[model samples]
Target: MRHPRLCAFLAWLYGNEATTGRILQQNQIIFPAIFWPAPENAPLDPDAVLGTFQSAPATSLPEVFELPGQTYLRNLQKISPGLWNGRTYCMKAFDLTEGRPTLTCSSGHFFDALVSCDLLEFELLSAFGEVMPEEEAFPEFCERLTLRGTLHALGNPLHHACGRSAAIGISTLIIFPAEGVYHVLLRSCGSRLAYLDKFFHTVPSLMMQPMLADERMEYSVRHNVYREYLEEVFGAVEGEMPYTPAQYHDIYADPAIQYLQNREAAGSARLLLSGVAMDLLKLRPEICTLLLIDDPDWWLTHRQRLRPVTMVDSRCGSAANLLERSPATPLYAIKLSPELELPTGLLCPERFTPPGAAALCLGLNQVRKLLLYI
Candidate 1:
């Protein structure tokens, strides 16, 4: 399907077809919360918790985290009861029953469990949940989250504050050659990093990033970006880097972050949005914002996560003016075949098939937009 991200998103929302009794069989556990300390400089609140928890260092990427195990996953698996009605498939439907996030969305009002987090569960699906199979569960699930519709979703994407998934991410652009004003060096990352995404064949991505190790750390709006950068890119023995203070850009809190509701793609979007690109530039802005588009190899590697698909191939330069374009227009798509098809049009598809993931599905395009400077 053309809009593969949308397909994965819908499938993730649908979750596994488990019975209600089966899911609840798992022992209930407190949904863990690592309370971040409020700013020391800020005035104290009488209503706030008395004990102080250190705030995590701030970073440009979504903070990688984990939730309480099987209970959370089982709860997600059983969320799709009313096919098209009620709270439906939203992970937000789960509420904080003590620490264990419990399902409680009968009234259909937006749940408060999500918004009440320190770092926030940006997307809400189990990163470890079972993969979505090839068959289409809902008849027109893919068709609904169109590329234009996705762009519309992103531009106005709200209400997706928090949920039950770990934030995932990858690099989109990286500069190269060191000659031109901006040499775009899209590196095919080392195969060792393949687990971050599909590495069936080495991919020369425009960006580079290491997967989050899922370590324990305090969540903060500042301090952590460089710490993560130094850890991921430089592999520094000490916490410091060789770059002079002058060479670096100002480290600051992220003014905003985009959030979409679908659990799988929402976490996956972190991989796309919060890559080494952000922290790298903070090292000294030599590496510009990573240029990224959701193409086919991307679809193959990250088929499970649902999102918007742009469907930009050789014919269409951008989705900006595709208002009248047919939603089902055949994508002049390609795969890593014996004979590779060369790019010739404004947009072209040059992708290779990976080991596993969905065969075909509709997806969404987050943007024709490019280059997010840190």
Candidate 2:
């Protein structure tokens, strides 16, 4: 992204202090632990409005935390700084002048009111930086907004402000059979919704699911993936969530939840694309995450499938016969790639596809040259 404005902001945000806030790229956010309140009784984050209501109250929460236990980085304290050599991780705590947002989420509903607050120990995760030692940080920036244009009615100023600040949670899964290699599925989110088309760019990669109001546990990448995958693919199961990563895997291993390929990827596959694409593989520890699973099964033949898009040549092209695609269907980006096709047949659609679909598929692939990563 031509982050000229973000660069200007960062340049000013880190005008002083050599080691602290300096970022190679505008997307790389740094939060030194020293900046955090010692007892992490932080100021409320902007997410509190939507996040707090989505989860059970602090009073009802159990002492134990549930995480994807499959991750390699066992405990944050147990691992060393050296382990983050190739990927990003929670590097070290430094100090940063926190931005005390004027608003905080109410933790009750998606459209709930934003409360006036300053301290964010509860939600503002501005204290530590998920540092990637290897790659250059090309950041992604966004502001949460409700795009109700000017003629919209607003009687209460607070309602207008909170509605304007409602957060949009954009979560993606870089499904890969092996490290650095991604499995992009073709998702047919419909030619209808303006929102889905913009975010997925009509043709997109990665599994996209927005956070529901009830998913109140603090945002964890692995858990987000696990929870979204199960609900989106398998439909929700009633029970306590698996507390350990292995338990999470056991559910995945179920024949019913067959999400992975039958076997591990045979060898490293390579691909070449003609657009602006770079693989930013930021390992755990670096991102705002609890490295949930050490390793996850990728070649999922999950039978409970979304209706595959109407492949151009497929005889079953009637409108009534097809299903509107889910965000997970962006796998078409992979089908378009000549180099990275897997050995499996179900994964690739016929090459001679529809021109309209082909155009979107290609356009999204072009954008991905800049956005694909784990």
Top of the candidates by lDDT = 2
Model 2: what TM-score? 0.30
lDDT of 1 by residue, 256-349 (tens): 1112112224333222221111110001100111222323233343323312222323344332233224333211122211122112321211
C-alpha RMSD by candidate, in order = 19.9, 18.6
Residue 152 local lDDT, model 1: 25
The estimated TM-scores of all candidates read 0.25, 0.30
Best by TM-score: 2
**Which stretches in model 2 have alpha-carbon errors above 4 Å?**
1-108, 112-163, 176-182, 190-219, 234-300, 303-333, 336-374
What's the C-alpha lDDT at position 41 in model 1? Answer: 34
Cα lDDT of model 2 overall? 0.25
**Model 1 off-target regions past 4 Å?**
1-158, 161-172, 185-223, 238-374
